[model samples]
Target: MSFYSDDASADELETLGWYHYDLSRHTAEALLLSNGTNGSYLLRNSNEGAGFFALSVRAKDSVKHFHVTRKGNGYVFGFNEFPTLQHFVNHFANQPLLGSDAGTLMVLKSPYPWRVEEPSIYESVRVHTAIQTGRTENDLMPSAPSLGTKEGYLVKQGAIVKNWKQRWFTLNRYELKYFKEKACEEPIRTLDLRACSAVQFDYSQDRVNCFCLVFPDRTFYLCAKTGVEADEWIKILRWKLPAVTLSVSSHR
Candidate 1:
């Protein structure tokens, strides 16, 4: 299934890069909120049921997932029905979508770019579902737990002195540990992911490609080699966090 619906053609799949088949609701929201600007959106299969789809859009400060259901021969979004998904997208591109609130409005500004090198959508969906349900993916799929690990070089700000120093960072399980060297046996510091309140992009520093891991007591500032590297770290770290932390993190 290249697209959400089997009726959608291969041609449509090639043209509609916004259609993310089998993407879980939680994963979709994370992608939009972490990487997209306001009004960025994507379409995906709805968790509600088959033959249903979702419109995940980046709103003012949060990501909203709107239900898209079949209405006879057309597609229904909010109060309107369109002959096709393209028509629905075209209409929303120009018009504002009213939220549940009286005055809240959301518009589709841009489609979040779909990348070819993304990790398995199945694995992402599994992890997201596990987090939401408070169960390990092993329970869901009867496979070995696949908690991911990421290792890279990043500049870290000293907690007390505030001086920046380069370190080898490794994110595994529920902890982010930084080592003095890539092959070092001991980590210089370990930031517990459970204690982490949020992870977000920070530009307050003079250095470029900066992001921070927010703890209740203090924040750890880190700079990657490039913007793409920084985004990768942020996304993986966010995924490994607990559901409550993720919910809080997304609102920021």
Candidate 2:
């Protein structure tokens, strides 16, 4: 690899320019690179280790994701092991064969330029202000450990682009974990209730069903699928950090 990062090894496989889909220009959370005309792409995620790569190809009408890992300056994709990146690159180097890749062929070759921000959940969700007297919620609420789970899409800050992207969220106990897709076993990132600076309900008034998780370093702008879900998540977060204020929407 060509200097993936400090953690990456120089002796490993060939490098591909991974195009990031995020709006942020800082971090490299998602990397995708394609020939533009070809549907195939070389992918990498900063959230994942440097050892892994996702090779996506378009076959017929369906797109496929193939898991590959770096091995001794070579690549092991799916079940086949290539001794060098050149061999793997050669396997899919044919122009006709590359055109079939689904991931990039359309996006790169489309007539219309792709727009990242459209009218979506980020626009639909509204944040409310808290009605608490002080910075603390009363002790009468249930604890974070008892809050259980909530399923929704959360607006997450991008690692590279510094923009926000919607991620599938699961609120379990004192933890909030977000994933690239629903039902994924591994989370892209997890937030600790114990480490949070404060949990504010509806801290931003622009969005409905919106809640904010405050931390010393950063803040999470999250919105539940519904107001009830947002309230429940805030209620649970308050229990974990008792001093955190409870926010109630004026509409509710």
Candidate 3:
């Protein structure tokens, strides 16, 4: 018998939307309520094996647009004990960016569910864990054919400094490979999509089209010459790892 012998069948399964869980519009409205400052909000239960976290950068931490997660919803600023837009407003009320006056709230751009995989665990393409003992699940494993190659500039990390180099990025069935140049014999950097659980865009200030590809072992900060290219990559990447549907009820 299979460990998940009682796995949900197609008929038994619920049809989840891009935001996931097919949550009620009311829940979504309540959950994503922001303080109306820089329009930052938290994504609760982003994906399997993860908890509530920020979809955008928190103005308080100044962490940029990278996804930030925590174990509990205790007295955290955005993730208040009583989760509400009011709580977020109250917490950051005094910030220079925010004030007593209600500011404009920015809505989440992508409706697809977001991915935030747990540390040290790659997404298993196979159902049986016993069969995947030695092999790591770094591959993207698209259901159909891959989207193929793209041209962009990726930021290469050095021992101390970071360098921006032009590279050719390829999306294969299992991984995202980047070559130093179009004709490089081998890839200079490889990101296992199965291990990469989350991705964010416009995270840094250096470039307008900057994006972040996050994995357990490392993070790739790639910059595209144009915003169109950055969004183009995000479209295909999110197809595999969508956005999240959080439950702000835990705010209590």
Predicted structure with the largest TM-score when compared to the true one: 1
lDDT of 1 by residue, 51-142 (tens): 57888888878888788886544588877888875786678668565575545677778887666466555543212322336666546432
Runs off by more than 4 Å, candidate 1: 1-146, 249-252
lDDT of each: 0.76, 0.54, 0.46
Backbone clash pairs for candidate 1 read none
Identify the superior model by TM-score, candidate 1 or candidate 2: 1
Q: Which candidate has the highest lDDT of all? A: 1
Ranking by lDDT: 1, 2, 3
Report residue 185 deviation for candidate 3 (angstroms).
Answer: 1.7
Over 1-252, each residue of candidate 2 has an lDDT whose tens digit, in order, gives 243553444433323334232223122112122222235343443234666665544333444455667777677865678887678656555432233233343322221122233545554333323333443444334342444555567666565666667889876666778999887889998888766766666645476677787787877777666777677777666656533333332234
RMSD of each: 15.4, 20.0, 23.0
TM-score, model 1 to reference: 0.43
Encode model 3's per-residue lDDT on 160-205: one tens digit a residue.
Answer: 4676666777776547788878788799767667566666795565
Better of 1 and 3 by lDDT: 1
